[model samples]
Target: MSKPQVLMIGGGMIAADQILPSLYQLQRRGVLGGIGVCAQRGATVKALADVEMIRRAFPGHSFRPYPDPATAGDAPHPLLYKELIAALPPRQIVIAAIPDQLHHDVIMTALRNNQHVLAVKPLVLTRAHAREIEQEARARGLVVGVEYHKRFDDRSLLARRRYREGWFGEFKLGTASLMEKWYYRHSNFQNWCTSENSDAFSYIGCHYVDLVHFITGLLPASVSVYGIEDRYPNGNKGYLWTDARVIWNNGACLNVQNSLSFPDGAPGTNAQGLSMYCSGGDRGAWLEHSDQYRGLRYCYTQQPDAPGSTMFAEPSTDYFQYVDTGGPGLEVVGYGFRSIDHIIAAILRVESAREDQRSTILDEIDAAGVIATPSNSSYNEMVMEAGRLSILNGGREAVINAHEITLR
Candidate 1:
């Protein structure tokens, strides 16, 4: 069959850091055909050099600029969306890995065009928005697989397969945690940071939240979340976490926190882990995220009924010793890889698009809400209403707040 065509949206940090590299891989292998990119500015990602960077990895034609408005988020910029819409062939696969704020508008446009979308995780700002976008997607029979990559990793996949294969027997208990702080004081607060509802709750903790559902094949019948925004506008909680904790309805729990103003070495001195046990056997492992290191690591052990024996195991990999955190510090390098890997798999999954073209209730509602432009007024209203409901209910409503309702 012919390779899938791609339209890359956004040339921000992720484009520079991960998507550009992964696209290069797909193109070289012949799984991808031509690539057209959309960036508000004259970013390198949309240039001819980008074309050569992957499938056509060598000098080709000069980078062509779509007649897009020159300014991002500058609505008055002429031809911004119009030029982008006209620049590509219809039905090209779109990767909506842009900033969270732009998630609604970009994905909505692509879906309306009937192009399949690989939306990044928690890309929707609210559950109501997720519901609306999903409704439209379902009606269109278009695929909207989320970007939850840890679910796609070979190791995590093995764990799930073993659980299903009866290797671990029956599962009764499962637990996961990500504890480390990576907040910067100088972080930009208004545009991208203010709307963040994470002090680890959504940012750091949600990965494992979605992963548990993927690996154990169990949903959190319900979840109770608690978080505090200590660092605030000053950047106390950095990017992912300032402080947070969560407990799942299945009795599984997720605990995470950004290092408070604690003295040095507090975050590293601690360990983070995931453990699950059932009738015949049990297994658990620790996760180590490093910036200076070449890769990530996972170490786990399975034990028989006996207390002092080993059924099997995967040993840990060690490669760190803080290069000396100066003040209110964190390593940004190690944090974004998980997002990168997820993007790679999501693109591949949507590119194939040959599943039974079916869906479970859970899969269809995987999104919270889909926010789009004024044309998508219904969805925009959904987000606003959900937020209002959250505030008025004191976070007591499940129909609106999954994490908070259980607490109430």
Candidate 2:
């Protein structure tokens, strides 16, 4: 059988760089059949583009443009939504990459009409919506999933292996950090470099949150946060922060701090890294600025040297040399160090659903959007709680319930 037909809801930054190319590859391999894409007319460069790009990539695939509600340009072309939705073949799986504010409407329409759905991260904007979507999909026996791809990374996979194998003793504390400056100055890049939005905590930091779960296999029961507001604000979509923190269920916690507001906006100099603490295993890695540490990047780990030693040293001769520099001055972004690779992998499926194991990670993705709380409704409440705490409560409190958490 050919790849199941796919319908992409948003055609912005993620679509252009990641999902589109990936799906086009799937199509070429005979794993995907017809493909359709809809991007509202007035979105920023990240999420908006002309059809020529898609046409050139998937020449034979069906591609179209619809008003994207998430973008400012969609206002004048509201009718395109239904037109795009209605034109799709019945039962085709829909991949919606829209944000929280708009997910409910778009996804519900598809579910009510009997289509499966694949959603991007932060599944729903609120707890209520989470419950609602979960119930709907299960009731309809349809697939619905959210993307959390950190679990797919090499480092993450090793962490999980050590945890499961008991290479680490009791697993006392785990800390994860996402720090860096990925901001764009108005004068440097063109009208815009890429991506219309880059909220440190919600958007970028979410990856670390997922990583916490991946390494420890422990889901956060709740989180209390502290965040910052950005100056440039990523093409004006708003909310780029300097730092954030999250405490999980096992009493082990995580601290996530990120800033697009770096004094220097280069990847190497802007620095971001993670450190984890466990009983038998303790590990950490960091980036040295291009000037001081040029090509001196490394990832070193250490175990207890003796039974009661309070200190640690390099366990063996194994360490990775970090190579995060390639540009002069401060514009090394032109190099191939874009985190966009991770984003692209999330949109792609390496194998057909049939070839994938049932009840595996990929299958879990389909179940991710389903909610255990809010009963038969969506998790709009939980999202409201997160949003409220983020904007109003000074990040001291976040609305999250472990029992109510829909997916692991």
- The ten-residue window of minimal lDDT in model 1 covers 368-377
Give residue 273's lDDT in candidate 1 (0 to 100): 49
Per-residue lDDT for 188-229 in model 2, tens only?
Answer: 221222223234565556656665555555655555545554
| Stretches of model 2 off by over 4 angstroms after superposition | 42-62, 67-75, 179-199, 233-237, 262-265, 268-271, 280-384, 387-391, 399-408
* Local accuracy of candidate 1 as per-residue lDDT tens digits, 1-408: 256677767655455444554554455446667766666555334443453222233223222343343433333232254356545565567777665656777778887887667666555666556666777776665555555544544455667677666676544555556553232223233235442433334443555655555555554433333333344555444233332323334454443333323222222322344555555534543322221122433333544332122333222222211122442222112223344434444445544555453333224234321211122222222322333333333333223243332224
Q: What global local distance difference test value does model 2 have?
A: 0.49
Question: Candidate 2's error at 294, in angstroms?
Answer: 14
TM-score: which candidate is best? 2
Residue 76's lDDT within candidate 1 is 29
How many collisions between residues are there in candidate 1? 13
What CA RMSD would candidate 1 show?
11.7
TM-score of each: 0.60, 0.65
- Give the runs in model 1 whose Cα sits over 4 Å from its true position: 43-83, 169-175, 179-190, 195-199, 230-249, 256-273, 277-407
lDDT of 1 at 367: 34
